[model samples]
Target: MNAISDTGAAGFLARFAAMQGRLPGDSTLRLAAANAFRSLGLPGATRGRRVEAWKYTSLQALGGMSFRAGAATAPAAKGIVFVDGRFQSGTEKNFARFADRADFGELSWPDRDPMAALNTMLAEDGAIFQIPAGIDAGLVHLTHIGTDGASAHPRQTIRLGAGARMTLIETMSGSGCYLHNPVTEAHVADGALLTHIRIQADAPAAFHLATLYVAVAAGGTYDGFTLNTGARLTRTEIHASLNGPGAVAHLNGAQLLSGSQHADFTSVARHAAPKGTSRQTVKNVLAGQSRGVFQGRIEVARGAQGTDGYQMNRALLLSPDAEIDTKPELEIFADDVKCSHGATIGELDAEQIFYLRSRGIPDSEARAMLVRAFLAEALDPVTNDTARELLEDAVARWWEGQAA
Candidate 1:
């Protein structure tokens, strides 16, 4: 099989079909993936509105742009860039926790091309960050910049070895008319702890789609916080699997939408082993004619006793034109497990505003304060004070502009 011949749409379909034969030898999984791709290949007219709970932030409004290959510019910092599914050489840094050549070499799939798997399974070119065993480290920053008129798909993979601890910070910003499709996969080994923070501030003409997948081993911990403030259309998905007993996962996210922009945050947490726990909180502020969506699901497998999970999603509509849709779900097969989910959508509290105004606070300032307070909950879990402060500042700046 000539893998290079599989480029573009036809190439993708052929390669995907070939890879389907080699995947875990699971016919059901192959059919599921094929069906997913077939659904994805439909025309806009046929697809129309999205029926998925997490797809309330529609990408169809962005017109007919599809993911294509292109050249990515030189990154300003230490990170990999993939333009149109091609990898570009980035500057090697001594300070950055880099993935060595051996790391890439070890990722081999028998009877299947790794590169093809990466291209078909992943949506973009991405870098990998690995925290070796016994390495307790500080934050590692990942910055993604998208130039105008180019579509880029980047995929990232991170692995944390036993007893390792680290923080990952991602900042995605771009301008011009383009699409950024990114996917990230993370593995937290036994006794490892990982803190992840993401910031998305793309241009108004940009369409961004991101998915993060995480696997936690026994005694591992995974914590994440995300803030999305830009892009005409953006969707972020986080999926985590608790594969080991005593694993823990926590997720927090906030989206600030204005103008005609749309943002969606969807997450799924699955507990496959005993004594695992997960919690998630999501917040959204919608103004102007913008829209936001939050769909979260927690699943506890049968016989996975001692599993605990909780999820909450809340939205604030600042204008009559603003809209929000939320769906919180739980699928528990274990009778001994505990799982719950809650969702709320409403306007600001009128009584609180009146009380603030009576206290001599200007209406604008009072409103901004209330909004800030509402957003602070998501920022509470950020371990890096600088990152937390930066997020706070960004929220404040956006709210101030809204007030003005």
Candidate 2:
């Protein structure tokens, strides 16, 4: 550990002192969570670069930023909004339709992630809902915003009853060099279905860390996608468990990064029951010395027979200094299972660019077209119309800027 992370308890204690009484959640729980974070200390850039999990990411810039509480703002139109760590007004109208299906709980994962613990310790408010069986909860939108150098921790819990269905869209926007940490837990009961889409478009100097944990019961399905186009540093971590037979989980995402930005997407899919299925597809577009990281792991339990797992990651580097790192791992203990994973890194195909250019398209436009096509393959799995449209629009806007 370097001096930055090795600050031990002093660093955490100082931060806790600055925003101690203002934190959300039960006091006892928050205290325990803070202690947990203090125990692990922070991850420093000098030492973090050597750690297996932090090999490609650095935290030195994070330590240099001084983060305070964010200001509370009113809800945006037609969605639940969280400003800083407080929920905005007017969300009561959607309580019956979307806001009442989740409840807060201690979301403890197998790994002791400091970011999650810190979020739990400081979060003042979060969304919780429990959708009843046979209900179509319609589309629910949640927006999180940060201002200036402020920091915010937003948490959420969602439970879908049997035969229920819901589509959720989460958007993050902010300015300056703020730190935003969000944690989410979702449970899909038997025969239930859920579609979740997250878009991160924070300021060019912001830091974002998001963690999601999901459990799917028998005959249930979970579809999730994340779009990362902003932020100086970001890490999106997802953990999914197929707890019952015939459960399905689909995770797909795209990262469009430029400048000196860095984005990392890590996920783990566990097949605990027989005949479960999991799929992961990720694409990255990097330019201007930007970096992208993808780490995906699929594990089949001892009796998880008839399991099917697939993972694919592709990267397009637009600059000589741009970099992409991908690792796909599979561990199967079952006798009957089909699993495969692949990763590819390259620039735009010269043949495709040539073909488009020969057809009257400008070189820049041809490159943008190729980039759009590359991301489209990863986004094709999203079936929700509204969510898909929103993501497509974001991708289109990013591409337009790139071409310009």
Candidate 3:
């Protein structure tokens, strides 16, 4: 805890003070988070010091903008929806509003992460879903809609009983110049399986900052994927902990950035027990003056022998001005663990484009086809049909905008 910026911290704390009475959950926890937020402030926004976690991204602009808690309206949909973090539509058997039951869960560390602290301090509403033992929840749709000039902090919680299975699809889409900060905590019990797919397509001028924490027990599997192609500045951070033997985790994602957009995907996978396995594969495609970032780390505990972990980051620069940053780290205390990490950064192959062009295809179409081929291999891991179609449509729209 060090000195932080008054301009950013003061305004944020002030908002909390005004709404302290109306907010739910235990007041003691929220107050503690508020104290931490005041101490940490916005990373790189203050002039005093900087932290390594936020080395590639800055919250200076977000700290300066004063967003409102204005009302929002979302288009009618068949799935559950939240407008500015408040419940709006749809229903499920085991679903409830965060505003109704605001338990912050036991996984997050607001005292260490400033963004998590902010969300803990001021989160108003979110989705809370649960699954019974041995039951299979086929598919769950959760969507968030934002409005202009407003800010929303939503806290989501999902828990699965032993032998249960679930597939969750989440989307964030809106039209605004607002800010959306959400924190999610997921619990996977022994012999359970959870697949989480996220698509973030916020308004062009909006800002998005999200954090997710997951815990997997013995014989459990946590499969996660994210597609980001919207917002002016976005950062999605994930932390996964394997707490029992034979637990598995798969963290895979793709980022398509264009114009002056900036997106960062940071993740940490920790194996605390023996025979745990984790794998991560990330792909980035950038055009114009866009910038993309990927930072991933794998940690194996002292007794966590026989751990198998591997991660790879690859980026394709579509324009000379496009930029990408990659950082991969592996920390192991056990001698029998097998872990490896690597990164590749390059532009598209001109020969491939020319080969297709010589076959009488237009230059733009040929280039698009090659790019699709590049993304095809990465999207293979996603087995859900609806999720696959959603990713394809999002990629197509992004490419169309870039070509225009």
Per-candidate Cα lDDT values, in order, are 0.70, 0.79, 0.89
Model 2, TM vs. native: 0.91
Give candidate 2's total backbone clashes: 7
Winner by lDDT: 3
- The whole-model C-alpha lDDT of candidate 1 against the native structure comes to 0.70
Model 2: per-residue Cα lDDT over 285-317, one tens digit each: 998899999999999999999999999998999
Ranked by lDDT, the better of candidates 1 and 3 is 3
The stretch of ten residues in a row with the least summed lDDT in candidate 3 is: 1-10
Error in Å for residue 202 of model 2: 1.1
Please state the error at residue 40 of candidate 2 in Å: 2.0
lDDT of 1 by residue, 22-117 (tens): 433334534544445444532131353344543455444443443334455645554544333345445433222122221221222211321223
My TM-score estimates for the predictions, one after another, are 0.81, 0.91, 0.96
- lDDT for residue 31 in candidate 1, whole number 0-100: 55
Question: In model 1, which runs have C-alpha deviations exceeding 4 angstroms?
Answer: 1-39, 42-57, 66-68, 72-124
Q: After superposition, how far is residue 12 of candidate 3 from its true place, in Å?
A: 1.9
Where model 2 places Cα greater than 4 Å from the true spot, the runs are: 1-12, 17-26, 45-51, 92-106
Best by TM-score: 3
Q: Judged by lDDT relative to the true structure, which candidate is superior, 1 or 2?
A: 2
